[model samples]
Target: MFLITDEQLDALLYDLATLYGYDFSGYSRPMLHRRFNRMFRLKEFSGFEDFRRAISNKPELLNWLVAEITVPVTEMFRDPEFFKVLREMVLPAVANAPLIRIWHAGCSTGEEAYSMAILLKELDLLHKSILYATDINPEVLKKAAAGVYPQNILEKYAENYYAAGGNQSFNDYYTSSYDLVKLNEQLKKKIVFSTHNLVTDASFNHFNLIICRNVIIYFNQQLQNRVLNLFDASLEQQGYLALGTKETLQFTSVNQQYQKPFPKEKIWQKI
Candidate 1:
């Protein structure tokens, strides 16, 4: 039960950015407080001073904190219908190109990005495509690069895959050993995993499709709009942008520049 006040929140964010180059200033204060308190309890810190001293003494603990704070609630094919839109409409729209580049922003643990790669392979577009999956967390990026996931979730993921309009045996995507499963090497080869913090990083390249799901909930409107603009600039003319089911482009500065082709799904096309 350590609780951080509004002042302490500002100081903590400042120190993280000024000293560590991690800018989380645009994140929601209440959300940050909740996550910070969770870390304090989980790490058994008595108070804010102790927590701060621990981080000062062992800078590496900051990485653990970042991982805990930014962890997204995700699963392979988490929203089946969204993936259905990508499979049926989005991917095909970009498949005609000789080379396709898709960006998966905040791609925690790489499930959805790999799901995209699997779909591209099934559609016979993998050879002409390259998937760029980026996240703010280096810890998750390492786990994602390895392509291993806990075996306990296999049944659920398989169900999601099937529900997302997957035609082949989902089992073909991975091999199980003990309590873990690793995605096929073929799928990993086409994906490039890297660390890209949305709050601080600029657009690296143009993309035919960008899948950034369930990531913006942490930000305030200003940061969300900044990110939407970055995505808009990085996307090719008429490229696709996919967000989490609850997320949207409406009411933002870039909302009018995009059109919702599949109204039911959260997929939009840049104008």
Candidate 2:
């Protein structure tokens, strides 16, 4: 029950970033404090200093922290109307292309990636689509790459699927066994899940569409701007960018660079 002072938290974060090169400085202070506090209690660390020492000495603990902090709380088609707009408007525009590269930023446990794959398959573009599902947490990326989800969640996802204009039965995309639903191999093959640090790493590839939903909300304005710039650079000319319904680039420096394709859904087209 040791209280973490502001100075202690700052020193701990700075030391970790310097030693590990994973920058969490841009994350919101309150959010970071809460996450760290939870981890502290769970691990039984006596104080912030103790947690810092463990993180420095045991690099694996840092990975655990990263997973705990960066993992998105998401579900398939969490925003159904967004996917509907994507299918009706964005898909048609990109469908004619010979190939498409999509980056699903902050894709946790692969729900959004699978959702995208299912949508592309319905549109007969799955074969030509390469989805890069990126998250900073390697643990989550491993799970996402495996494409297995809890069986209990499938019913809800199925409802989301139908609501988002699914063309076929959602059951067709997964096989249920025991408590798990293994995503179809066909859908898994189209997606490449990888670990990516939006705060510290440079953009690696240009994508036709970048769906970074709800990830930036925990980031400070400076970090959000940095990530947005990375996304801008990573996107091709006239590419599409989709954000969470509650997020927007309207007041940001990059606001003028993208036009609103569907303001309600928060889909923007690169200008």
Candidate 3:
């Protein structure tokens, strides 16, 4: 395995920002080092210089490199209790929304967004809702937009679905062929998948709820604050914000501005 020195990592990060307009400098160095070293071996780079040059000289590789480095770790209906809260509490809180707008920030491959769609459809709010699922990596967004996933994971997702109060047959939501399944059209049409960088992108629109779970953990304090502020600005008054279970707003600038509805869950309402 090719190991990346601190200096080499710094230089590579600089080039990514300067040349490709991808700013990764605010990410935690230790996390970046781990991902970069792992990437080096996965891509079969002989040494630090080889890895650095491959990215610096060839811009097209940025998509895969970014996807690999960020590691879009997500699963359908992840953290069943959180989805249960969204179904039982959050969805009802916004039940009266005329045209529900939910932003799935850092929506890696979009299982959570599809999960939300199922929740909304179950509640008969799907017709008036729009879900914007976004991620920094376009490669992942493609899969999210496609609404396709491996068939083997369906069993796990089905367990989570019912745990989240699923009202219909879980199998009814998709069709399988050749070891993969595509989510039903009803779920796919409501979501608009696109590329968004939390590190630098500005808020594009206001939303009723912003679910950006488990994404900012890789960032340092400064970047975390910036992303939180962006989400704060993007949310409408009394809008909801949900983060990963292990993540919190307690130490951030916007902590005081939002009220945590459930003590156990990370869902918060803008006050």
The best candidate by lDDT is 3
Error of 2 at 1 (Å): 6.0
Task: Between candidates 2 and 3, name the one with more favorable lDDT.
Answer: 3
- In candidate 3, the residue pairs with backbone N, CA or C atoms under 3 Å apart (3 or more residues apart, or in different chains) clash, namely none
Q: How would you encode candidate 2's per-residue C-alpha lDDT over 73-96 as one tens digit per residue?
A: 888887888889888889788877
- Scored by TM-score, the top model is 1
Query: lDDT tens digits, residues 27-62, model 3?
Result: 888999888887777788777777788887775667
Better of 1 and 2 by lDDT: 1
Q: Which ten residues in a row have the lowest lDDT in candidate 1?
A: 65-74
Clashing pairs in 2: none
* TM-score ranking of the models: 1, 3, 2
Cα deviation at 97, candidate 1, in Å, is 1.1
- All candidates: TM-score: 0.96, 0.93, 0.95
Q: Whole-model lDDT, candidate 1?
A: 0.89
Shift of residue 161 alpha carbon in model 3, Å? 0.4
